[model samples]
Target chain A: MSAAPRSASRADPSPVPVIELRGAAFGYGEHAVVTDVTLPVHRGEIVAVLGPNGSGKSTLMKGILGLNEHLAGTVRLFGEPADELRDRARVGYVPQRHTLSSSIRSTAEEIVATGRLPRLGWLGRPKATDRQVVARALELVGLSDRAATEVATLSGGQQRRVLIARALAGQPDVLVMDEPTAGVDVASQHVLADVLARLVARGVTMLIVTHELGALERLLTRIVVVDGGRVTFDGPPRRFAARRRARDHAHDTHRHDSELAAGDTAAVVPHGPADRSGQAHA
Target chain B: MLEILTTDFMQRALIAALLVGLVAPMVGIFLVQRRLSLIGDGMGHVALAGVAIGLVTGLEPVLTALAGAVLAAVAIELLRARGRTNADVALGVIFYGGIAAGVVIISKAPEGTPANLVSYLFGSILTTRTSDVWVFLVLALVIMGTLWVLWPRLFAVANDEEYARAVGLPVLPLNIVLAVLTATTVVVAMRVVGLLLISALMIVPNAAGQLLARSFTSGLRWAVAIGLVSAVGGVFVSYPLDTPSGGTIVVLAVLIYIVTAVSMAVVGRLRQRRHEVAESHEHEHGPECGHEAIPHGDHVDYLHDGHRHAAHQGHYDEHGADEYGALSRDDGPTGQDEEVST
Candidate 1:
């Protein structure tokens, strides 16, 4: 629904994509997890990567972020080879938030300020501008007041917001989020959705790897589905939903016949209305 | 007591204690943060072998121990950084070998070296030479100067290694630096806090510091304060009580940790009772109240202090955007927050 108006307005957009992957294969060590991926994320586009567990969705994102090794084909960030990208601060990463260590005694502000480390190397300290950026990032995530509070003292959702703020603090051109809404409650998901919506409104580009789509489905411009370690589908969210619905109907008729159906439908499906995922991961 | 504080040896011991107290926790807080709380212990164990090497070869034990610990630290880091199964097993083997080798090697030294080993195992404060104090001072300065340049990066790496690397802050190198710092601290403190018990000085004060401090900045301050008291106080305590300075300092730190823990526990209980009192004070909060009312979920939350409170089943329920209410009362709201959208 949100993609139609944006697509119509993109008649004179940037020529080069923020991230481009061509026939790319990504994995840890010598083993390839995802292969032959052709994807380009442009400015102001929110792309959702969907897949079954261990289906290489994460590996693809990691490959783009230069975490996973690119075994075959090319991966580029901001038109530069992933490995050769000199301006690292151009990309922001929101890793899955772990339980904050209580003993570390880091405040929310301290945690978010670290996002500026790329710009200010180990020896350089955070100046006025850096502090302003950190404060603005905290404000973007609606965590301005929680800045001084110990991260351990924050709620799960608040902790998650702190992580997003940490990413935003970097002032990156593209945000790479790996399951930003995973393991969070509905209300927290909604809050995270609002934060992301605000960010998108500011023209922040995003490439998210998530199984659950309910929280961010409305804002999604396109859906890329990775199955059997390949890009099976790449289209608008509505088309993807429709296609999955038809596939699920065919799958349901044979559900009883196949004893070893790979995915558990309920488990793979996002928890919301029927159209949220329409069916299990394809 | 006053005269003991005046003697050159006593004064030197006190200065050394102060320096040990100051620097041990400075390096220690990061170690504790990395969950490598016992890395200092491992380094300490390894440094003992270096000490034995010095004693047997007739060199300064402190300098030899420093060299030993630094080399072992780098080797352990390189192996651990390689990230394999045997690296872990090798680490354990090395640590075990260090202590056993130290004991075995020290036995081969001159007859009086065995007697001298007592001061190395448990600190003998009066025996802390002038040169040892200068070594401690220089090493302490080096540790502090390094931390000053790398504090934020170190904290970031310690807090989350993957995130730090994602942001491109050289995680492995920082971790290596931390290991080296642990080694340097262990050996520098050996003459005063004994190689055997050096880790206690490194960790216990920081542990105690965390019991009361809620922020990293404050935690560092608290740890240093606790370390100073324990180290300096231990020396003073040993003079009157006739105890080993190392044992006294470790015991003092443990005692401080115990007291802080018990005190915090009691305060938490009191806070629980205080909640009941606040319940009685709770009046109807609506449009008439001056406090700003923010919409929260199914109900309305009144923004007071830093967090929001909503009425739930006739009692005030703490409200959060995610409904995962985290109520820590010490912190206050500093500025305006972006509206949580519906």
Candidate 2:
């Protein structure tokens, strides 16, 4: 069964975007990293945001997650203003793997149980339903056997899965991940891809910020490429590949013929995967 | 030891020590985990200023110290939130400022002020009044109750602050509450370990517990146990040795930390050797032994230095290398390339 769009109905008529950003700019403090970007993520859609380092892809995701407030324009979650959305449990966030410090000595079960914090009461006691949800999340990530294991003792791949399980336990309608596969092993990446596929099949909307598409290439319904703090391209993966190749060719000829000004060099050098895969695609 | 416990003064001191011991480490465990161990020191300095204020005004030093500490805690949190400086820098500013202010305030006070200041600074557990014991008891209950109610939120914030914020955990209020708790712990512990050594009481036992513990709950239990033993044992030893009570307690706690750290290293080495032996045996046995016998070397490496090992392992992994390549290729003009590796 396909995942139903949350809160979408005939009376509403339109499928409310799970995440909506119009001319949004986001950054830390006074410095804006992602600017003038308009993007909408519909229900059940898997969107991959690709960008170079310091290109503000993560910042954009942070804006949607409300970790970083939008400096400009409007950001809406489930048809509500981003900052005003009270139902945070509906949007689960899986940050980069290293975000969890090594000093944290929690078991996988304990970590997954934390995802239930929003659903829990002030005392933060996990009810039977919470426990069952946490268990199911661990099972979904194929980590039920390792549920009691200390996260510190788990492999990098296993730790990543635990993080995914933590987000899943929230039962969020939308999953936002920042560089899910970065620094992960190839085998683990494949495992993550399978997990993402299952999540998609379950109708969970995903907005992922990543450098390399790799195994995630197949699961993506749309790809958004950011360059120099702006959304340069947003379309289907196939069209992205086609457009990227054409852009790379034009960039190559421009680089070879032009006097190579600093501005020219910066513009031609597609940050992140675009630069590395430029030749491969050509 | 039994004879020493007979006197009313000794009994009061021991009770205070035990009470501070139980609550201090409970608070300290969270502080250490959050890398805010020095917050105890900062609050201790502020407590000194409070003590000076009490001396000059003829008020109860403990109550004044508690008030001073709470105010200082709020100020530190405010400064940190305002981004006037980084956390450590802000803490350092308040830490030294409080001590300096206390010194200046004490200098202008009555004749006995300096002596009282010294006692507070170094701690005089033998001189701990019955009223002080009651105050410590009340503070312990309040602090422990607060921690009990806020355990999950505090743990989430301490473990991964960004994740806590993303999950809509009230990170700011939780942080302020933690700061206030740290202040309370420091103020209460100051009677046993002194303002100067309060952080030792707040850090050493928790540090030792972290080394020995494999889980959060176990770490907390171990910390409280270690702290209690150190407090009572230090007082017991101090009476016989004729040493300072606060210094003795801090020394014992430090000794526990050192011993635990060294033992962890020794144990890690032995485990590494065992893993090496197992790996060699697997190599000799060939493909039938399976990849399970291959031994995840990173696990052993992590025990040595988890942060560095994790970073290195991330770099050494196949995907990390690919990302590194992609990163290096993108290092075009900004000269900010090394960031991607980290």
Candidate 3:
């Protein structure tokens, strides 16, 4: 409850980045998987963290989300230390959709409703406003009619949207999604990009981790390429295209990259300046 | 029929059974949803060691069991939270270790034979003392009160732990809380359901509930209802049949689970066959029809608009839509529909 009130003057784009990391090193044990990473994600900026199969991109995202141990430097959220920041509601998170176990008995709406838990706290039951927010989230994802449908019965694309709606339901200041377009059909991938475009239009800040950035290429305001452990390139989509071939990002036979390749990587339109550059990563 | 229930021991058994029935499934459903159904079973074994401790020390076995189980639960949960040891490995170590230790510890006690531990192993709810009933009542109140306040949070964690952690719910504490509640439940129901059979009471009724459960909330309610019937009914059944209550209760729950499973499968098949019957109206029997449904049995029936047409054979059979309409309204589409929609 002592969580600092977030900056109300969002119209001016607050000087402090919503999420800031300074020379951070994160890993499970003593060994650092990702090291010496300095990155700042501002409000309303859609930063896509791109990498090859085992480039520690996911590790960096997890470190930002406070899932992994911060072995080295500073990691801050809403301009506060990671451990001291109590208001986790300000950050809506959508993990990899596959992490959700199969055969969940919850409805699409019910799964989304859980996103409201951080706001409601222990004693507060879900009120009408909470229900309305959940409905709005489902509608935003075009699953309003599927509000009562069981999650298990939904298709993979539909389930992914459900996970998106779940993250959106919290009305977080920044949404951190891990591979939002992974493991879905080509049509679904485009639909997800459109959904993301809408979310961006609403000025929602995001930090997405994905191997295939071409699907979300149009909406990406900035690209942060993490090859090996550290940041190799951090610039706009256009700059990333020009600065391509600086390093050999060999994407081995990882499960994620292969799925998108086999499953409609072509249907996702390559951007204006980075068709070949994008295909290199793909 | 009611006179047998009026006896003092019967009243205690019924009351205790009702309480266990009410409480077991509340905790069990989350474990079942998380696929940690066997955690309770492992805790039961740990509680056995606690019971052995109590027997040796001349203290109440239930209290000792509660202490042992809670400590083991917290310890095991801590190990899991550390991200080093998996729950599977912890369960293996503690599950076997607890029982082996109990067997050894009980042998050293003066009044403890392997025979003395029999009641502890299988339960002795009929011979439950008044004080023991009061103790269980208090424990039940504690568990229910905690769950009443935290069931939603507990549910969110069980539904998806990563999401729960992201949402800033104290995932570790809540997990530890669930583990502690599980240990307490092991002690509370152990006298009635027995340590060996108690986890079945926690799981079987919920398994039956999931067959027809519409959602988690509904599933939980169904589980509690099924658990209540199995617990109280098993008590009554055991009285007349001269059988063990714990065994009878677990058996009854398993029977209900089988019945529910068989019925659900039957309903699903009936829905598909009935859908085939419903399809004959718009469906024409030809290669152009492109109708391939349920590659089971000899043929598929197209039941639509009061006529059943045999698929691919250009044969039409008349049927009553009235009789089949009830089947059409069956819960929702079967698993077969998932293929068509996706």
Candidate with the greatest TM-score versus the true structure: 1
How do the residues B102-161 of candidate 1 rate in per-residue lDDT, one tens digit apiece? 889998888675437778878888788899889989998899999999998888888877
Model 2 earns a TM-score of 0.81
Between candidates 1 and 3, which one is better according to DockQ? 1
lDDT of 2: 0.77
Ranking by lDDT: 1, 3, 2
lDDT of 3 by residue, A121-196 (tens): 7668898999999998987886665576667776666788888898888889998988888887665566677778
Q: Model 2 over residues B30-145: C-alpha lDDT tens digits?
A: 77768777788888998888887887887887888899999999988778767664776777878888889888887777776444666788777666888988999899899999
Best by lDDT: 1
lDDT string for model 3 (B90-151, tens) is 66898889989998999888753333677777766565667878988999999999999888
Each prediction's TM-score versus the true structure: 0.84, 0.81, 0.80
Which regions of candidate 1 fall more than 4 Å away from where they truly are? A1-12, A248-282, B111-115, B276-301, B304-341
Candidate 3 regions exceeding 4 Å error are A1-13, A242-282, B86-90, B108-115, B276-342
Model 3 lDDT at residue B21: 88
- Candidate 2 error regions (>4 Å): A1-14, A244-282, B86-89, B111-115, B276-342
- By DockQ: ranked, best first: 1, 2, 3
Point out the higher-scoring one by DockQ: 2 or 3: 2
